[model samples]
Target: MTASTLARRGLGVTVVERSGDTGRTGAALSVPEGLLERITGLRSEQLPRTLAPGVQSWFAVHTALHAAAAADLGIHFRENTRVVEVGQDTDAAWAVTAEGERIHADILVGADGHRSVTRRHVAPDKSDARYAGQVLWIGVAEESAIGSRGWPASVAFQHGAGYTLIGYPLPGADGSTAPGARRLGWALYDSSRDDVLRGSGALVGSVVQHTLTAPEIPEHTFEELARDARRAFSGTWRDAMVDSIRRRAVIGTPVAEYVPDRLVRGRVALVGDAAHVANPMTGRGFAESLLDAESLGAALSSNPGRGDRTRALLHYELDRLDAVREFVRSGR
Candidate 1:
């Protein structure tokens, strides 16, 4: 997002990614009207119609942003490049890749992620994002598989027995909202899964290691989730969930939260999960990342050259650090 936003301000960006052609699943995003245009500086007509405002697939939003970044001539991607270390001197910030290539820019933006290497350089004392006390079981169900049922007009919330479920309607992959073409996306927050996480080694002490896919989940765990769905949710939400369970389409993500002690240092800065990780249940992570990019771009929009990079970055930190800290702390 920082890449596209900086590109919007006509700054060249070299994105150092760990992999090429990445994918995500089992999550929904709140895409506000003109969100894509705001993030990418791309015209609405140039974006995919599937990226319209409303609840959207996480994968769809990511793909759209990747496409938008690709379309921008100012943005350059170094796919499959891993940044092992990040540093900055008085003049500039740079990243050292695994292949020994030191990529330097006028200013380096570490939009890396929750497990950010850049974060290590920015806040060494508070480098890791600690695991929150819940695991989110996320899934998407095809309306066609669920048969005839009244479609959800808006987001639904159900809370019972230490469990919270949020279910919302999403357009089909083709952006169709018709009865037969729509989809259901749900996230179930279970606070009683600490043992499973520890046993699977997906959680070490308090840090999250990975998300658990269906293939990795124990059969009894799926059974328990299915049983809980019937007890905790009702009506269409329950039906969609039961179907998803039967199909074993769920993935368990041990939630993590981070309160930033700092978001910037010198010419290097942090954004998104790299800076602060909010509670997933707040549904604010994606939007907050957009805000980070927007604020970063706006902060540096005027400082085109490298004369005052530190001041501009400090301004970005001042703009976001407190707000993002409050957002994360409140979501807890």
Candidate 2:
């Protein structure tokens, strides 16, 4: 989205992605209503029918969120263009080599996910991706199937002590889908080091499989799972929360990591999870991504001169750094 906004405003914007397509299959995204309105020009109701409407004001729980509609803005996204290296051209414009092709642009924005290639190119001395000691398993179920009203309703939450499971409605597909087809989703959070879960994809897989067996289970079951799912840990999960999640659930793991530095040189910047990732507990990634696009676009628009633009990039980095640093601290 930021790439498109920059290009539309007359900046040379090119996006390089590793995937062959952008709309890859995955769970729906939750975005803020205002961000959606500002970017896409769509009111909440105007969002894709498939998007479920969850509470927009809460982060402790998940919901079906909307992104603003920016009809005038569209980006030509290229898939399968993995950024292998990043450097500066003699003129100081950012040069990026992806796959086998090379690209030169006035500025570079890394919207890549957590394991960002741009971060490595700009700051090779940085540490490896660190895990956030928590995992989230998400899936959608019918709203009515659960015999519940619609959005604004809390599915279930067990925030006792160290473990938690939050459930909420996300918007859904068109009429072909049922009403309560209101996306029922949940996140299972456990705190532990990644090494403890080492090579235990099978163990993680089994735990998720077990979660689906019942409509609800004691949250303590989750605490046990969290501990047994890896090496010994003192962390605990609520019992009632685990039971509720098990009743209707889909399993997933939301791994977290962050880049200590926000800016890569003067010409390159990182956004979204590529810059910093908050614990899924914050549920703020989508909101931050939209804001990032707006901030970067405004900075470039305000400072068109090379010198001013370079400084603008620095300002942009500083602004996001403050926000991301706070996000990291809050998650801790």
Candidate 3:
């Protein structure tokens, strides 16, 4: 988003992605109306609608579309490039890629996400993300499968003894909302420390990690999750839960949060999850990231050339720091 905004303002922007292509995941996300307008310069009516009201699109579609837009704006994207380290001197900041290439820029924006190397370079003493003591298991299934069981197009929430389940409709893989083509995305949150994390060996400090497609997730785990869902929910929701668990891959991750003391150091600036990682309960992670990109671009554009660039960057950090704090507080 920063690259697209800067490129639109006629600034030379290069995006370094560690992946070979725009990565796609089965997980779905809500794109807020305000973020849609700010990033695309389009109103709600002008944007593609989602099955869920007020959401612009899912994560995969948004990613692909944003990448295409950035490409059209002449932003250079260097794929298969991983930044091993970030360094800056008085004159400029630089990133050292894993391939031993030094890329220099007057300003270094660390949009590298939660495990940011740039954040380490800028604020070495900052605290790491803390686990929120909950694990989330997520999967998606065909809407038809759920609808046939009489599930309505609405958000459903169920709480068991020690778990919470949320299910909602998402557009199809191609971003379609047509009947039988839509998808149901569900997340089951379990706070009980059970065999799932222990068997996977994903407990790294406080954070637990396990992808749906990873081999560590044994088949019995899925069966257990499905069985638990059946025992917790009733009717269409229960049936849908079982079907989704049986048919789709289930991804798991420990809920975590990280709010840094500061957002800038020297010529380096942090954005998105690099600066603050709010709980998913807030449903504002992606929105906050977009706002950070917009704020950074606006700050840089307001101070063209090298003169007063540092001041503008600091202003950007200050502009967003309060909002980020509010988000973290409210989410907690």
Candidate 4:
């Protein structure tokens, strides 16, 4: 996104990604009205519309849309390339890839993610991301499979003893609203302790874990999740939850937050989760990333040339830091 925004400003930009393909892990995202235009110079109506009041779409669809726009603007992309470290000299900033390739730039933007290598180099002394004592199991269910469950088109939430369930509609695979073409997106939040997860044999590793696909989840765990859903939700919401659990691929991740003491250092600037990571409860992760990219582009475009680039980066950091802090605090 940062690369695309910069490219639109007539700046030469290159994006280095470790994955061979674009990210497809995230499920649905709700985008507030006007955010698309504010961030990407694209109208919200240009994308698929969701049954959920405002704009909502699959995360992959949103990503592909922005990626296409960026490509149209002539931004360069390097896939399957892993960046191990980021370093900057008095003149330029550079990324050292695992393959031992060095890519230099006038200014390096670390939009890597919550576990950003650039962030580690930029602020070695900063605290690491902290777990927020919750894990979210997310999935999508075909509306056709859901049958006549009478699910609401708008977002709905149900709070349980130690968890919460959120449901909303998503555009279909083709980004359409036709019957049997839409999907119901759902997330189940479990706020139990690590001991509970461990006892259930679910916490197999790190603080943050993802299953990627539903079939990969243990049968026992899936059964327990379904039982829990029955207890927490009712009517169509519960039906949607069970349908998604049984029919769709699922992904789970421990909620975590990271707020860096600084967002910029020398010629390097951090954006998105690289600078701050808020819990998904804020419903602002994707939106915040776009905003970060937009802000960086505006800062650089306004203060052109090498002499003012560093200062502009600092200004961008100040411009976004407070809002990020609020998001982190609120999400927790």
Which candidate number would show the highest TM-score if scored against the true structure?
1
- lDDT by residue (tens digit), candidate 3, 72-175: 55677777899999998889888899989999988888887766788788788873666677777877777766665565567777888578877776777666
As a whole number from 0 to 100, the lDDT of residue 179 in candidate 4 is 70
Clashes by residue pair, model 3: none
Query: Mind giving the per-residue lDDT tens digits that candidate 1 earns over 59-143?
Result: 8888878888898889888999899999988877899999999998888888888889999999999999999899999998888
The predicted structure with the larger TM-score, 3 or 4, is: 3
- The digit string of per-residue lDDT tens for model 4 on 141-185 reads 778887645757778887975788887777676667777777777
Q: How many clashes in each candidate? A: 0, 36, 0, 1
Better of 1 and 2 by TM-score: 1
Name the 10 consecutive residues with the lowest summed lDDT in model 3.
48-57
lDDT of 3 at 258: 81
Q: How far does residue 16 in candidate 3 sit from its true spot (Å)?
A: 0.8
Query: On lDDT, who's better, 1 or 4?
Result: 1
lDDT tens digits, residues 1-332, model 2?
Answer: 57545655567555566665323111445555554446534566665543333332222211222122123334444556667777665466554555466677677787766667777765678623565556555444544544443344444565544656565545444423445444444455665423334443312421211112222323554455544423322112222223334453434454555646655467878777677767666666777777788788777878888767677888777667787778766766
Sort order, lDDT high to low: 1, 4, 3, 2
* Runs of candidate 1 exceeding 4 Å displacement: none
- Scored by lDDT, the top model is 1
lDDT by candidate, in order shown: 0.87, 0.53, 0.72, 0.74
Runs in model 3 deviating more than 4 A are 21-25, 34-37, 42-59, 198-201, 207-212
